[model samples]
Target: MTETTPYDADRARFTRQALARLVLCDHAVAVADGAAGLVATENDPDAGPGGRVSQAFQLIELAERALVSAVTYERERGSSWAEIGQYLGMDPAEAEERFAADLDGWNTAFDVPYRLDDTGLKRVPQLPTAAYDPVSACARLDTWAGNRLVLVNDEHPVSSGLTMAAPKP
Candidate 1:
């Protein structure tokens, strides 16, 4: 079997650049901020493209951060390792084994089951639809936005809002 790849070639390169910026600023969000925070944790050249588990886990972490978006987001509806791997022509079980290493740390809280659909927000409104594809939808939006506004659209549990603790020192 081929070794698991972490991210696509372009993503790996972009992440390398982002991480380079992020590391220089240390771990300060005020100094780092938004996409900068993403860049911060990704700067390890030692990681390489095949080290995407590290990068994906970091993104999984930051997406849940409230100060960043005030809402926990799960791209499971849009993207998952198994799903991505399948799209890339790999076995789901094998794909998971290669990149699921980060689950040990992330599992401390909760790790979501990959869902093909969370009741069809795609077509049936409240029922799961066989035809919905979140990844494709987001891809179109990104293209329409001139590739400037990239996002992983997903369903969120509605809350009154969120409360955040002070950033760690």
Candidate 2:
């Protein structure tokens, strides 16, 4: 696969992907909100307790995923665990543990091979999430980013007793 592309084209592609993701997220939130309302009101037998229970479960899952997404975004933007902990009214260690699922999802989403800098910072290139191939893409990233160690940090699933590895090149 060719990596070279005009900057404008790359930006346009990124814009489209981002917009799609945003729209989907908005729709999910709206659905979850509607479910919340339904669960709070109405008792029609056709859509009563059972339906409400199902909707409530879905809302919980959606809320969890949203929390993960938000935490991951904040972490990527260079927010420290202490900063995030303050925002969540928790200690740094508690915050890390609570957001473990979020960190795991973020790690999987961006698990392509990368070479971390001296400060454990890797300038990750924006890749299209569409048709994402973690294996081949990580191999390509290794070539582009060189051989450098990614650090064990709060964003890693390893912090939560999970292990991850870059795909074989």
> For model 2, how does the per-residue alpha-carbon lDDT over 25-90 read when each residue is reduced to its tens digit?
433444556565764444556685587777777777777655665566567557889999998899
RMSD of each: 20.1, 17.0
Best-matching candidate per TM-score:
2
What TM-score would every model get versus the actual structure?
Answer: 0.22, 0.44
Model 2 residue 22 CA deviation (Å) reads 4.5
Q: What lDDT does candidate 1 reach at residue 50?
A: 57
